[model samples]
Target chain A: AQSVAQPEDQVNVAEGNPLTVKCTYSVSGNPYLFWYVQYPNRGLQFLLKYITGDNLVKGSYGFEAEFNKSQTSFHLKKPSALVSDSALYFCAVRDIYRGSTLGRLYFGRGTQLTVWP
Target chain B: DVKVTQSSRYLVKRTGEKVFLECVQDMDHENMFWYRQDPGLGLRLIYFSYDVKMKEKGDIPEGYSVSREKKERFSLILESASTNQTSMYLCASSPPGYNSYEQYFGPGTRLTVT
Candidate 1:
């Protein structure tokens, strides 16, 4: 089964400092990885996805994630943290090989990121 | 902009009551899904329908059921609402034949079972 794990329950970072939210995935064949963010009382917003190509993929709100196949990880990163960036982050994996499971996303437990001033 | 809309933003119900949460998408999407979000747990898929009259169970589909009679509408039903069923229910839709498989989500319905 395809799955992803977000080890940290919460990550705290100071404003102007770089921040990272860790994610590791396991899938059959090649993986389709994704990162999504959810603000207070809002549905999740897609941050980025790693379908193919570059190891490092840029996403919305100046965020980027590196798809490290060797490490089985796709960690979200930002050069600088902002107070508004604080939210819940989720990592998901999907099986591209068709059948009944097509387009179904298996999500991680989620990590709450807090950026302090 | 692609739009996915839900029936209610918030709903309160008593235990054992029947409940329905509806979702409609305007982008002619062929896929619609139902997910429940809880603290710590990001989003758990409950049910998904790829087209009218076809449904598939997700990782957690117990105590929940879904209907997709129309192309654009999907409905989630809780036969007997329980306290454990209280959660933020989300609906999503995705266009078919897209390489990215990017899904558009609705704002969600917060359901509270008393």
Candidate 2:
């Protein structure tokens, strides 16, 4: 079975400062990781994904994530946080070997990110 | 822009009543999914359909059912609405064969069971 863990329930950061939200996963085969952000009363928006090849992946809204194989982690990062960046963040993972149709993702509990001015 | 639209943004229903949540995507994607979002639980998949009339049970499918009569439409059904089933429901669609293809989401429908 595949699973994801977000160690932090909430993260606070000053605007213009770098922000990091930690995520870790456990899977039997190669992992397909994804990050999504959700605003209050809205649906989740895709941030980025890590399939293969690159360890560092850049995403929309000046966000990025680093995939660490040994650590079994994929932490979301933003060099300069904005106050509007405050939202709920989710980390998800799936087993690539299980085939595409079976691409059911295991998601984390979610991290509430609050960017202060 | 590709649009995924849910039929309602908010709904209130009585317990034991039958409810239906509809979703439509204009991108003609091959895969559509239904998920319920609760505080601290993130999104839990209820069901998904890869093709018309073909559906599969997701991680959490109890008390919920789905319909896919057309490629662009997917509907979630609650046979008997319960208070515990009240939550924000999200619909998503994705293309086939693309391992990295991202899932596009609808605005979501918040359902309240009395």
Candidate 3:
């Protein structure tokens, strides 16, 4: 079974300051990690994913994440925060071998990021 | 562009009534999924269908059923609607492959069962 953990329920940052949202995972095999964002009364939108390759992966809306194998973490980062970026973020993981099984997704509780002006 | 459409943005129903939530995908993807989202729980899968007329149970399948009469349409049925079933229901679809292709989602239907 695979599982994802989002350590923070809410994160606050001033506009123009760097921001980070932490995520960790526990899976038997190599993990297919993803980040999604949801706006108020809207569906979730894909942000980025980390399958393999460079540790650092760039995503939409000026967001990026660094995959740390040793730490078992995939933390989302932004060079500078924007007030418009405030929304709910989710971290999800899937086992490499399990394709699209019922247990494919192990999502975090979600993190509400608020970028203040 | 891949487009997934949900039949309703909001629905209200009474207990014991049968409810059907419809979803359609235009990408001709082989896989369609139903998920329910609640506060603090993120998203939990209710059911999935890989092909037409082929359905599989998901993490939380109790009190829920699915039908895939066509490749592009997947419907979720609540046998007997209950207040516990009230939540935001999301429909998603993805291509059949090994690579990590992101699942396209519908706007979601917020069902309120009373």
Best by DockQ: 2
Candidate 2, B17-83: lDDT as tens digits: 9999999999989889999999888889899888899898888999999999999999999999999
What tens digits encode model 3's per-residue C-alpha lDDT throughout A2-116? 8999999999999999999999999787778999999988888999999889999999999999999999999999999999999999999965324544235667989999999
User: In candidate 3, how many Å is residue B58 off?
Assistant: 0.7
Candidate 2's TM-score on the B chain: 0.98
TM-score of each: 0.96, 0.96, 0.96
What lDDT score is found at residue B71 in candidate 3?
100
Give per-residue CA lDDT, model 3, range B1-29, as digits (tens).
Answer: 87999999999999999999999999998
Give a tens-digit lDDT track for model 2, residues A2-107.
8999999999999999999999999887888999999998888999999899899999999999999999999999999999999999999865324554466678
Cα RMSD of predicted structure 2: 1.4
DockQ score of the complex predicted as candidate 1? 0.59
Measured with DockQ on alpha carbons, how good is candidate 3?
A: 0.54
**How many backbone clashes are present in model 3?**
0
Report the poorest 10 consecutive residues by lDDT, candidate 3 chain A.
A95-104
Model 2, residue B36: C-alpha shift (Å): 0.5
Error of 3 at B20 (Å): 0.4
Better of 2 and 3 by DockQ: 2
